[model samples]
Target: MSTARWVLHLPAAATSAEGVDRLAQALRDSLRHVPALDFGELTISAEDDQSTRRRVWCDAPLGGDRRCALRTNHPDRCLDR
Candidate 1:
Protein backbone atom coordinates (compact mmCIF):
# COMPACT_ATOMS: atom_id res chain seq x y z
CA MET A 1 0.00 0.00 0.00
CA SER A 2 1.12 3.53 -0.71
CA THR A 3 1.79 5.85 2.16
CA ALA A 4 -0.26 9.03 2.43
CA ARG A 5 1.60 12.32 2.18
CA TRP A 6 0.76 16.02 2.20
CA VAL A 7 2.60 18.81 0.47
CA LEU A 8 3.00 22.24 2.02
CA HIS A 9 4.31 25.37 0.32
CA LEU A 10 5.81 27.78 2.82
CA PRO A 11 6.17 31.49 2.19
CA ALA A 12 9.45 33.32 2.26
CA ALA A 13 10.42 34.29 5.79
CA ALA A 14 11.66 37.71 4.75
CA THR A 15 8.40 38.64 3.09
CA SER A 16 5.92 37.02 5.45
CA ALA A 17 4.56 38.48 8.69
CA GLU A 18 6.45 38.14 11.93
CA GLY A 19 6.45 34.76 13.73
CA VAL A 20 5.59 32.84 10.54
CA ASP A 21 8.94 31.13 10.62
CA ARG A 22 8.39 29.92 14.17
CA LEU A 23 4.95 28.65 13.25
CA ALA A 24 6.32 26.82 10.21
CA GLN A 25 9.10 25.24 12.19
CA ALA A 26 6.64 24.03 14.82
CA LEU A 27 4.50 22.37 12.17
CA ARG A 28 7.52 20.83 10.48
CA ASP A 29 8.83 19.45 13.71
CA SER A 30 5.51 17.99 14.76
CA LEU A 31 4.64 16.39 11.41
CA ARG A 32 7.96 14.65 10.92
CA HIS A 33 8.27 10.84 10.91
CA VAL A 34 4.67 9.98 11.52
CA PRO A 35 3.35 6.43 11.16
CA ALA A 36 0.57 6.62 8.54
CA LEU A 37 1.03 10.16 7.28
CA ASP A 38 3.74 12.47 6.03
CA PHE A 39 4.00 15.98 4.68
CA GLY A 40 6.07 18.03 2.28
CA GLU A 41 6.53 21.65 1.28
CA LEU A 42 5.18 23.68 4.20
CA THR A 43 4.29 26.92 2.44
CA ILE A 44 3.53 30.39 3.74
CA SER A 45 2.27 33.39 1.85
CA ALA A 46 2.15 37.15 2.38
CA GLU A 47 -0.75 39.23 1.10
CA ASP A 48 -1.70 42.88 1.17
CA ASP A 49 -4.68 44.02 3.25
CA GLN A 50 -6.79 44.53 0.13
CA SER A 51 -5.98 41.07 -1.11
CA THR A 52 -7.86 39.56 1.82
CA ARG A 53 -11.09 41.10 0.56
CA ARG A 54 -11.06 39.00 -2.60
CA ARG A 55 -12.77 35.67 -3.08
CA VAL A 56 -10.94 32.38 -3.14
CA TRP A 57 -11.89 29.87 -5.81
CA CYS A 58 -11.51 26.16 -5.36
CA ASP A 59 -11.11 23.71 -8.25
CA ALA A 60 -11.72 20.06 -9.07
CA PRO A 61 -13.76 17.92 -6.66
CA LEU A 62 -13.87 20.83 -4.22
CA GLY A 63 -15.02 23.45 -6.67
CA GLY A 64 -16.49 26.48 -4.93
CA ASP A 65 -16.09 30.16 -4.19
CA ARG A 66 -15.05 31.34 -0.75
CA ARG A 67 -14.84 34.79 0.74
CA CYS A 68 -11.76 35.69 2.72
CA ALA A 69 -13.67 38.12 4.90
CA LEU A 70 -15.04 35.21 6.86
CA ARG A 71 -11.61 34.70 8.29
CA THR A 72 -10.51 37.11 10.98
CA ASN A 73 -8.13 37.31 13.88
CA HIS A 74 -10.86 38.57 16.15
CA PRO A 75 -13.91 36.35 16.24
CA ASP A 76 -15.60 38.28 19.01
CA ARG A 77 -15.52 41.50 17.00
CA CYS A 78 -17.10 39.79 13.99
CA LEU A 79 -20.44 39.48 15.76
CA ASP A 80 -20.49 43.23 16.53
CA ARG A 81 -20.46 44.11 12.81
Candidate 2:
Protein backbone atom coordinates (compact mmCIF):
# COMPACT_ATOMS: atom_id res chain seq x y z
CA MET A 1 0.00 0.00 0.00
CA SER A 2 1.78 3.10 -1.26
CA THR A 3 0.64 6.68 -1.40
CA ALA A 4 -0.82 7.96 -4.65
CA ARG A 5 0.80 10.77 -6.57
CA TRP A 6 -0.55 13.46 -8.90
CA VAL A 7 0.57 14.46 -12.39
CA LEU A 8 0.26 17.34 -14.85
CA HIS A 9 -0.88 16.94 -18.42
CA LEU A 10 0.39 19.30 -21.12
CA PRO A 11 -0.89 19.87 -24.64
CA ALA A 12 1.23 18.38 -27.41
CA ALA A 13 0.50 21.19 -29.86
CA ALA A 14 2.25 23.76 -27.70
CA THR A 15 4.79 25.97 -29.52
CA SER A 16 6.15 28.51 -27.04
CA ALA A 17 2.66 29.50 -26.05
CA GLU A 18 1.43 31.39 -22.98
CA GLY A 19 -0.62 28.53 -21.61
CA VAL A 20 2.41 26.29 -21.66
CA ASP A 21 4.35 28.97 -19.81
CA ARG A 22 1.68 29.39 -17.14
CA LEU A 23 1.56 25.67 -16.64
CA ALA A 24 5.32 25.53 -16.31
CA GLN A 25 5.28 28.26 -13.68
CA ALA A 26 2.48 26.60 -11.78
CA LEU A 27 4.37 23.32 -11.88
CA ARG A 28 7.54 24.87 -10.50
CA ASP A 29 5.62 26.43 -7.68
CA SER A 30 3.76 23.21 -7.06
CA LEU A 31 7.05 21.46 -6.36
CA ARG A 32 7.30 23.34 -3.13
CA HIS A 33 6.11 21.00 -0.37
CA VAL A 34 4.24 23.68 1.54
CA PRO A 35 2.52 25.18 -1.50
CA ALA A 36 1.89 21.83 -3.12
CA LEU A 37 0.17 20.60 -0.01
CA ASP A 38 -2.37 23.38 -0.42
CA PHE A 39 -3.57 21.99 -3.73
CA GLY A 40 -4.95 18.61 -4.70
CA GLU A 41 -3.13 16.00 -6.75
CA LEU A 42 -2.29 16.96 -10.35
CA THR A 43 -1.03 15.16 -13.39
CA ILE A 44 1.89 16.37 -15.45
CA SER A 45 2.15 14.66 -18.79
CA ALA A 46 2.97 15.68 -22.36
CA GLU A 47 0.84 14.85 -25.36
CA ASP A 48 1.90 12.16 -27.82
CA ASP A 49 2.64 13.63 -31.25
CA GLN A 50 4.44 11.80 -34.01
CA SER A 51 5.24 15.07 -35.74
CA THR A 52 7.74 16.97 -33.60
CA ARG A 53 8.34 20.40 -35.07
CA ARG A 54 11.40 22.58 -34.70
CA ARG A 55 11.39 24.20 -31.23
CA VAL A 56 14.10 25.78 -29.20
CA TRP A 57 14.85 23.60 -26.19
CA CYS A 58 15.93 25.47 -23.07
CA ASP A 59 17.28 24.26 -19.78
CA ALA A 60 15.79 25.47 -16.49
CA PRO A 61 18.78 27.08 -14.87
CA LEU A 62 19.28 26.42 -11.20
CA GLY A 63 20.18 30.07 -10.70
CA GLY A 64 16.95 31.10 -12.46
CA ASP A 65 16.01 32.12 -16.02
CA ARG A 66 16.28 30.01 -19.20
CA ARG A 67 18.58 30.37 -22.18
CA CYS A 68 18.36 28.97 -25.71
CA ALA A 69 21.23 27.00 -27.17
CA LEU A 70 22.69 27.18 -30.67
CA ARG A 71 22.74 23.43 -31.34
CA THR A 72 19.55 22.00 -32.76
CA ASN A 73 18.03 19.02 -34.51
CA HIS A 74 17.06 19.12 -38.19
CA PRO A 75 18.32 22.68 -38.28
CA ASP A 76 19.32 22.47 -41.93
CA ARG A 77 16.26 20.51 -42.95
CA CYS A 78 14.00 23.04 -41.18
CA LEU A 79 13.23 26.76 -41.82
CA ASP A 80 11.74 26.34 -45.28
CA ARG A 81 8.38 26.49 -46.98
**Best-fitting candidate, measured by lDDT?**
2
Off by over 4 Å in 1: 1-16, 35-40, 49-81
lDDT of 2 by residue, 7-29 (tens): 54434345545555456446445
Q: What is the per-residue lDDT of model 1 for residues 7-30, given as tens digits with 9 covering 90 to 100?
A: 544434455444665564465467
Backbone clashes under 3 angstroms, per model: 9, 6
Score candidate 2 by lDDT. 0.38
C-alpha lDDT of residue 62 in model 2: 28
**Number of colliding residue pairs in model 2:** 6
lDDT of 1: 0.37
TM-score of 2: 0.26
Q: Which ten residues in a row have the lowest lDDT in candidate 1?
A: 54-63
lDDT of 1 at 48: 49
TM-score for model 1?
0.31
lDDT value, residue 23 of candidate 2: 61
